[model samples]
Target: MTQKNKMKKYGSLFMATALLTGALAGCNTDEDTSSSGGSGNSASGDVIKIGANLELSGGVASYGSSIGDGAKLAIEEINAAGGIDGKQLELITVDNKSENSEATTAAIRLAEKEQVVAMLAPATSGNALATVEIANKYKVPIVTGSGTAPNVTVNDNGSVNEFAFRTCFIDPFQGTVAANFATKDLGAKNVAIYADNASDYAKGLAASFKETVLANGGTVVAEEAYVAKDVDFKSTLTNIKGKNPDFVFIPGYYEEVGLIVKQARDLGIDVPLMGADGWDSPTLIDLAGAKALNNTYITNHYSSEDPDASIQKFVEAFKGKYKEAPNAFHALGYDSIYFIVDAIKRVDGDITGEAIQKQLAATKDLSLITGTFTVDEFHNPVKSATVLEFVDGKQQFNSKVNP
Candidate 1:
């Protein structure tokens, strides 16, 4: 009846399903795709399954990999410390391949076939948006780590999506921070916007940036758009260069953002670039090179350079496990899983999605590796954002902006 015995009895089916699904999706087996490591248990079938639907492969795989690492670390620690009630945590992670359709499919598979009580949505807003519909339709609660676009959890009519929740600040706050920093601190008067037209995340941040820029007595000299997965950005950069804006604002994932930075620098555009949390990934530096990323800035959820005791502890633990410093996505993912587990404990080990959702709605002042914040009515976290400046290929802490 213990957790280990329950998993030994029931985990075969879960393992088989995961293997079959991974084969079909061509997912990486070596990664921490699943965790069921509880060794001893005293109750029967005391295993709590949670779904992780993320971009584990494809353009934004870096985000998925880092987030997965963070979540895996948290789950390991939770299970080691004795899981909620008597149940051990089992994370069944699936790769959405960084596509909206794949995210929807992954969510469905987790909810129906995998039978996860709750879901951790993808790191990107576009993918998270697709999962939102599936989560609501299947009555499953889905939480996101870094899907900051406003509409990720809030519907178009300004109503909250009852089953959708996120642990990061929304696009408005992020965009406004970038704009405020550019205008007030950097003193950029005219700005050019290069946005990913194919991504809701990019479009939402771009819209907010433009609005904030205009309101702050700045002019948008030019704005160009590109679709996701587009490797060719010379034409867009050339067009933006013609306008000669003081700063270029790109609110997209690191895969494309890194390319844009390199291409822009190649085109002799020396203006500073600013971006949102989507820019937080190791792939960015790998693709763009350290020198090209110099003078760039991003609004993020956490800074690795923070000297806070809790922040330092998390950094050390993450580095010890992953052999690399954790990024904003890692912090967000770590906090998100903790948030879900905390809610589960508050409900006295109720593994039902409904009960967990109710507790998530009431989350307040929960201290996390990222920061302490409460869930607002729209299911968005009201937390502070750190503006990080990339200098010599390293992210240095800048100013902190509160929402």
Candidate 2:
């Protein structure tokens, strides 16, 4: 072979090698590279996967359904307005069945199998608590909107769970609000407590309410406990009625609380009923009956009747979308998703579990559909609670308690 031909062949080979190397480097660039977990390209080339581990069916189905609906509204609006960094957001939902063990399994599926960047934890504090283990194990952040139990994000030793956060105020504040409203507004000097012993949320709120009732110089005449899914609260109601308390505070899910209220009223023991956000379900009115729901109040996250522009806009949007006013659970679910989207936007790239978690920790006074609040050091939102009264089977906005 000629010397010129040999040089040409070697040069051509070198150029080919350089071209291949450049192509490989290009693929590793920011636009082409994908992160691990469901947030990355494996889930969808141009969509961000967010896990919605919710109790879509079972005792708390009403709460879960409302929450999911609100989340759906927020997701649609966000996608319509150009999703985070131009990538559409996708929700990968799993039903926890309103059970703690199932919640843990759902979290595992979301974190390990689906590889979601973050999860909107179950609507209940009990379920959220169960899912926390998976969040920490997988290094993914999980935020709950309606989990009001203080320990939902705060550990028993007063430390914040790094991967856990919630949008709602803690039970201490909510319970205190209820106590004050009962004693100050209702002129109640004696109160009875009925709690869902099976639920961490109910137990936490009940304990806080008792503490506050004493602090406010009101006597807790009696206290009773009931398990979830227990339809019969007649005996408990009879015991509470016998106490002759001026009002009864039942911190439990709407499902059981509805029956409890109906039974309490049926026994001719009609005082006043107060509860936490758990009672903000439409089914509660249906189950308890409009007459039973009268003279009742609950500490809620948001009231659809709020005159605030943001609140009104959200309410209108939700009503337009679902053809029903958004409840506290719906607002909570909507706000939780925006929080996640905000964190993802702040990160700008590589939507991974670690990245989203870090950004979520740094969140500031983020305005949301529920309320405006900053995430405190303990990962609990520093927000206000709204006191709502049931009038003619509808929840009316009574007042707002700011932090």
Candidate 3:
């Protein structure tokens, strides 16, 4: 049973921990979140309900909006091709407002009030982690398109959250790839790290990246920090510039990173800058002018410039629909909808959360717009990552790193 597409765990609930990262071996199947529906089977008559708790209106709005756009496109195509078992898929999206508390509230609404069979987690790791317990409690499979934090699937105590899954690789993989790119691809002997102090996302990437950088005999000449929502990076850039490092890695969201890049360039700090997927956003180019964004690179899920026929097809279709080229987040979002439907197709019995969760756990070698991947024991997707270079504020497909 294949054709339509190809592509791409949990521990306890750690309220505050490292963001963007792993898993436990145990699986739990407890049911309690739904009172009217059994095993969170909101899908009954002619529609399958899937909830999307996304950051649609705040700081990280771009990520959620792009994901929503991609998911909508997939739903349209799947419905046109005859949706799962003659039932149309319905996505109930709740705007998390890019806040953790809002995300949790949205998850509660989706799981308890809305009673969706399965739900899409938030785009950011911290926000996604906030919704894990809701999924586990309700026995609803919560799939995240780009939550790369390992703890999203596994707890700090080494327990796997059975209902949680992610399509993107964890932060360690992303960091290691970026470090290898900086040292091996860019020939850097020394590197500097500037991270978001307020975000575990930035901190997690910085930790993994530093370890790999030191492993490669590269020196961290300077380390700096900034909180989220920072508009001024000149002071930090001044310090970073004085270090005179060959490469600078800023593991933060697009908002701060954009200002950092523009200010860094203004200060004549012309070294190559790098980051993880958090840098993928349209607002980044507007914040940091195209010229300032040049010589920057990011370890991303997919690039619109990739020449693969499948990828190009998705890009063209996305451009036609949204009037803009798709980014890594968009591709991941598109892949996620198909991922859930793929699992639903294999369910012979009730389309309950338990049934869908079981099918999702056994997914193997499924290909999607991002890449082909299988769900690992920890519930994270083991897939290749792409390195995209920014030239004139546009992402160019650099190379792919296979695990």
Candidate achieving the largest lDDT: 3
Model 2 spans with C-alpha error above 4 angstroms: 1-44
In model 1, which range of ten residues has the least summed lDDT?
A: 34-43
Q: Give the TM-score of each candidate.
A: 0.87, 0.87, 0.90
Clashes of each: 6, 1, 20
User: Per-residue lDDT of 91-168 in model 2, one digit per residue for the tens?
Assistant: 989999989999999998887678777889998888899998778767788998787788878889998788898877
lDDT of 3 by residue, 1-403 (tens): 2432321112223422323221111111223422424565547889999899998999999999888889999998899999988999999999999999999999988987787988889999999999998888778899999898889999999999999999899999989999999999999988999999998788999999999999999999999999888788898889888889999999999998888999999999999999999999989999999999999999999888888899999989899999988888889889999999999999987888889999999999999999999998999898999999998878888999998
lDDT tens digits, residue span 279-328, model 1: 88777999999999999999999899988899999999999998988898
lDDT of each: 0.87, 0.86, 0.89
Q: Return the lDDT, model 2, position 88.
A: 93
Instruction: For candidate 3, give the lDDT.
Output: 0.89
Model 2 has an lDDT value of 0.86
- In candidate 1, residue 263 scores what lDDT? 96
Flag clash pairs in model 1: 1-43, 1-44, 2-41, 2-42, 2-43, 3-41
Candidate order, TM-score descending: 3, 2, 1
Please give the RMSD of candidate 3 to the true structure: 12.8
